[model samples]
Target: MRIRKKIWNNDAEPIIAIMVVLMVLGTINVFSSSFVLGTTDYENPYHFLRRHVLVMLAGLVLFFAFRKINYRRWRPLQGPLMLAVIGATFLSLVGVLVIGTEVNGAKRWLFGAQPAELAKLVSLMLAASTLSARIKRGKANSLFNVCNMKYGLIVVMAVLIELEPDMGTAAIVLGVPVIMAVVAGMSFKYVLGLGGFLALLILILVNVQPYRMARLKVWFDPWADAQGMGYQTVQSLSTIGSGGFWGMGLGEGVSKYEYLPEAHTDFAFAIFSQEHGYMGAFLVFLLLALLVLFCVRIANRAPDEFGQMLATGIMVLIAGQAIANIMMVGGLLPVVGVPLPFISYGGSSLMVSMVAMGMLLNICDHGRNAGGEFPKGEAKVTKSKDNKVHLKLVK
Candidate 1:
């Protein structure tokens, strides 16, 4: 593998700036939102703030570490890395069921971290490596061959996460890989069939679980049971509405004083809106949009199919979760335990997001350095006389 002399360049500057701004804003909002909860629960007003800062520091370390390392280094270790992540995820998911900490009647956390969070990055990596190899070998021409072990691993992980009863995260774990596969050139018919199956599965899951069904109802009308099942949504809407245009001015919002649940994690954006109002909320959205745009740009410019797939997967992962969290908080969608990326106060989530961004930045750097020639085994698509798509390796 060739190493670049300069790690910092204009190509990576915008993303770095975005990540820094989000992290700083996240630190401030986390403190503002969690001070009361920290005081009441831990007898220390700064308890959550302290933990948030510590996690931020750890995440920064990972961000820089991944940024400095070559993204292609992982290709050689894909098999071992995939197997290790699968084993760890399996154990963590099962162990959480047996001995995991239960919060809000859900056992999604084991040893103070969510294994489902880590699974997202690993699954994407596995998909990129598997799909790139298939493209290089001309094996991606068939849907059956393309949906290989990597897809199986993704489905198994999704099932385990669903068993953790975290449907939102499960959807992400399952959905993002399929998106990468589509980018890798899976047939639209296959995608449509998979979509129907997932929709049916979601319907079944919701109907089978009374709580999910109730959430769907509350999503339609939170005021129906404002003090019972719809309490969080009601409070969230009120909190956001109170912000008006200019907001209540940071630290002055009243919702975080026990009115809204998970104020610093799942509903952190609501608290942000309450404090900074419409303008602040818009700014955050714009930043997230820019981040996604830049990642897509990186994917388009990546030197090889593998790098392109990796960047595309990361882009989808971040954008999807951010959209879900914001919509859920605004009552536009049914509330799920999805957190705002980078801005939510969760160690596992923040760490994974930062590391993913680091990998993305590394890909951007590679794109900048690769002038014309690409790495060996670069996959190119060709169409035969019979109108069949084929991959030609440009070694």
Candidate 2:
């Protein structure tokens, strides 16, 4: 008997649903958190909100555009993409130092784009491609072989970003690739050595910068300098505390009234917590957890080692950035300029995140249709005597 099979199972629907919900929540939170700053800085309460909505719309466009492309196509193009990303990152980072706009004492923007954000995504792609190639060649286990052009370029990118004085982003750029390498089967001893080197490097970086040291000190005791260096942390904790079990109600947050800084960007979660309470905070956590789980599933089902590594890198990027931002806000870590993935009000961050999700969804669709193994008694394909292709279910 003839049978039929669905060409596309839409395994990515859950991820898309979660993404849309996060975007909607983000839109509301951005407006709520930024109106006060918008009014003060631009003399219009809707200034930031309007800009944010435009960016979100553009992000959605890119998301759909990327989703339609084949994930495997990126593998062949990795070389050119790697060079382009490295060049753009180098120029953008240096150009920012020369002609980029300065916000709060750091120059991290050039031509309305944050190259560091784009670098993160591209670097992961390059890492995945390079590592997968190494694994295929039987050289993945060699530390010397693994430390190739791709790894070096990524390190350079991280250094340039750190020079932007954005240590938080630099850390993500540096850390995620190592995680990918480990997943690619790097030896444990090398992993430990690399970890020690990274930890020592972080220590030097933190100790070399007075501001970083201050942030570290503030992390330890915000109340010691509550009115000065530690003001934001103290206010963040207070804002979250005030939310109690249920938030203060949307738009009723008091911290955005100049008590807490960067309310819509790096510390957006605090404002969100202040307005929505513990339940709201938990909801965001749940969504992120779900997103991470979905990413793992996609990685496991990816069509090839390349796709698997790519998916793994994307998962690490989202989870790592979200954890860093939330921890910074909660005083579990020193303040870092990392933004919450979909929830932060930054165009570059949102755009990059959306594009990454798009690629992930593409991987999910590809895996479902082409990669996964078929179960027994499911539909099978055969050719008839007339040379017509037919699908039949095993009895």
**What C-alpha lDDT values do all the predictions have?**
0.85, 0.85
Stretches of model 1 off by over 4 angstroms after superposition: 1-8, 76-82, 137-142, 369-395
TM-score of candidate 1 relative to the true fold: 0.89
lDDT by residue (tens digit), candidate 1, 91-125:
88788888999987889898899999988987788
Reference-based TM-score of each model: 0.89, 0.89
lDDT for residue 191 in candidate 1, whole number 0-100: 74
Error of 1 at 233 (Å): 1.2
Least accurate 10 contiguous residues by lDDT in model 1: 368-377
**Model 2, 266: alpha-carbon shift in Å?**
0.8
Clashes of each: 0, 2
